[model samples]
Target: MYMRYFSRLMSAMAGPRPVVFSGPSGAGKSTLLKKLMKEYDSVFGFSVSHTTRKPRPGEQDGKDYHYVTREEMQTGIANGEFIESAVFSGNMYGTSKAAVQDVQAKNLICILDIDMQGVKNIKTTDLNPIYISIQPPSMDVLEKRLRDRKTESEESLQRRLNAAKVDMEISKEPGMFDATVINDDLEEAYQQLKQALLEEINVVKKVNMSS
Candidate 1:
């Protein structure tokens, strides 16, 4: 019995998990996720998304996003390659199942930085994903962050801010996410996120044990 228990424990420790981060633009989802990747070597930063947006300065293909043309994306969609796809601000974004499988194959936890709509699509899949919503400390701070980016025009910034308000309200809805972290203090937020991942893994282990 002791050996059986030890084996089970070892197997559980070796297995990978899937984590999802959902939030609106300028909510610091990407920033927090990038920090987590740097701090946790075991994490597999899933390059799950393909986008129509041109790579920003210093952004590398396959590192930031798989850059694709509109025609290629349409063909991929026709082939049912993506688990979810969405268009925002005239740019196309998609998450491919192949990307998730690539991470799982390496026995590392796959983390996705996705939007709220993409989260809904992921829920429909067989993957048992743990969702985390990264929120700004306040709308004022969120606006400031967006403006500081200097990547958008005034009209676009206003649109994003308006969208963020709606996203925050949706995040507050029951069953929308497993956990929420406010990216006000970077260290504190990262700590909370790490703790939440451990807690979810524990819950899954308990479930497996009972079964």
Candidate 2:
């Protein structure tokens, strides 16, 4: 039928999609992402974020983040050069459209490490990325992990814990994420995260081949 042909045409055009990783501080998001990058090598790439904040010690221009001046950032926003931009502590932070395109151009998965707000911001765009939330098993474990890893003061720790509480709650909402992987066990969580991230990729590949 005509409908079948149309569906196959759409499938022929299908390709890799981006991946969004959202979670709270001290959640094992970074660890899992590191493993994926290390093992898969060139299968994925990071969409470097742009920031108005001054480059920190030993930080590179495009590797760590695409550091830009406030004026430049504001101009980019006005020109619609960014997929999403937000202000934090007087610094303008954003992800450029070109940054994401760079990864896609390389035929690699564009992985974004974002907060809940960033996740929501990305949802407004046409990029329908696979959303995966890395959450701690419980608030108690989250608190302990932050305390052990970070040397921040007790007050700062409390602030982070409170923010994690909010993130934990929001992540439970239906349709907020395609998959929610609890980071209770690092190896187990990584396996789950890897599977969720790759399923979308497999679908795109299969569709392209069959079409």
Candidate 3:
């Protein structure tokens, strides 16, 4: 009976609040997030976003995102189903309340990796989350990182750089984020992220052990 109770508790909705990660395109958010999730797989879950854009090569529905038609997304937004939604480059993208709740139901910390606009939209909602901004060491470093990828055209690269500048500025606004992690040294940045989330991490660990 106690075991059953523990199992139920582990799956309860009272788990840790969701976490929001906002940063520029080449800010090492993915690398740091990969490390954290790999280290604590059972304790973290990524909140899959919804998008009206067609899936890219190798993208899977419900995994990379919930691919929907423009009309469907529009209807969902109209009905107040999405917690935060935005239109980017002619495609609509959003984070539905259900997506976050799905992760919470599993008693894992939900991670919302979004851009600056999405961050601003979420700020207006009642869903309280710990916002963390991952920033590159400098504009030069960010440019270098993007160049290393060699995936963007000259035009696309320039666009990303411009957007990164705006994102960096927003991240600097006082009280915008709970913690701003400048990802200069990958190891040090990971350590800082862990420290910022230490309290919540401990809670999840305790629940896991008890279960």
Using Cα atoms with residue i matched to residue i, what is each candidate's TM-score against the true structure? 0.85, 0.82, 0.89
By summed lDDT, which 10 consecutive residues of candidate 3 come out lowest? 1-10
Writing each residue's lDDT as its tens digit, candidate 3 over 1-211 gives 4335433443544557889999999999999999999999999999999999889789899999999999999999887677678876568999987788789888899999888999998786656789999999999999999999997788889989999999999899999999999999999999999999999888988987898
Pairs in clash, predicted candidate 2:
none
lDDT of each: 0.79, 0.81, 0.89
Best by lDDT: 3
Give the alpha carbon lDDT tens digit for every residue of 1-211 in model 1.
4345434433443446688898878878887777767766554446568999999899999988999999999899777777679888888999876787777666567787888888888776656678899999999999999999999999999989988998899899999899999999888998898788876445544644565
> Candidate 2 residues 1-211, lDDT tens each?
4345434433442336888998988998888988988986567889899999888778899998999999999999887777778775467888887787778766677888888878888787667788999999999998889999766689878877887888899999999999999998899998898788776556545554565
User: Which scores higher on TM-score, 1 or 2?
Assistant: 1
Q: Per-prediction count of colliding residue pairs?
A: 0, 0, 0
Better of 1 and 2 by lDDT: 2
Total clashes in model 3, counting residue pairs 3 or more apart in sequence or in different chains: 0
Better of 2 and 3 by lDDT: 3
